[model samples]
Target: MAESSGGPKKLLWVMIILVLLSSAGAAAAIYMVLDERDDDNPEAPSEEVVESKPPVFLTIEPFTVNLADDRHGTRLLYAGITLRVEDEATRELLETHMPQVRSRLLTVLSGQEAGQLTSSEGKQQLAAAINERLSEPFDENQPPPELREVLFTEFIVQ
Candidate 1:
């Protein structure tokens, strides 16, 4: 009876040690994996640590022009455009060449049909056209203006 009791006690101690060793090994593996990840990506900035620049916008005055006849006798488009320029230099370039900018906008607006400007796709196409035209350099010697977006604040067709 004494030997049986001792045998069971020794078995229990062995089991407890195995469990402790397994737990320690698991903890070490987890620590190693996390440490390796940190070392592998040392330069990755967390979202909270990232910095962003504010947007710059350039607003153009409203335009009223005759749309394509489309056999509708007469049609007109009234649009207010705002340009999202890449930087202050682009905005200044547009402002300095206000006459040329207005001329280009008027030409694009007047060429659109009233029916085509009424839909969402048409409006997007119009915006793209405007962006393309505005991106052209005012001076052949200088780089073209960088336009991020062409937004129409107001659109009315009659």
Candidate 2:
């Protein structure tokens, strides 16, 4: 009876020690993993401390010009223009040269008659010419201006 009781006591002590050892090992493993991760990014940025910038909003003024005389006579044409610039500096450059852009547009449009201005081919030609003229003022190394499309807001012949 004594031997049987001793055997059970020994087994119970062994199980307790094993349980404690396993728990300690698991804790050590978790600590090691966390420490390694912290070393990889020692100075992680805090969410609240990080700053974010707002998106920029850009817009261009619309253009209006008179077309050259045709069978229908002189015509007034209005166009809404939008330009995609690389950055604020490029935008400033464009604003500074707006008068030149306007004059070039007027010259190009004035050469066309009412019939030519109304046709699809003529509008495409005008768009291409405007893009070309705009690129002339910017630095040669800089990317060309992005002209998405040209729209005729008003067209009237008198």
Per-model TM against the reference: 0.72, 0.49
Residue 142's lDDT in candidate 2: 64
* CA error at residue 15 for candidate 1, angstroms: 17
Which regions of candidate 1 are displaced past 4 Å? Answer: 1-50
Candidate lDDT values, in order: 0.92, 0.67
lDDT (10s digit) by residue, model 2, range 1-158:
34565887899999999999999999999999998998799487655766654433235556566777776766777666565555566567767767766777677766766676567787778767766776664555766555444445444433
- Which lDDT value does model 2 have at 44? 77
TM-score for model 2? 0.49
Writing each residue's lDDT as its tens digit, candidate 1 over 1-158 gives: 34556887899999999999999999999999998998799597766855665777999999999888997878989899999999898889889999999999999999999999999999999999999998898988989999999999999999
Candidate 1: count the clashes. Answer: 0
Over 4 Å off in model 2, which ranges? 1-58, 138-158
Clashing pairs in 1: none
Q: Highest lDDT: which candidate?
A: 1
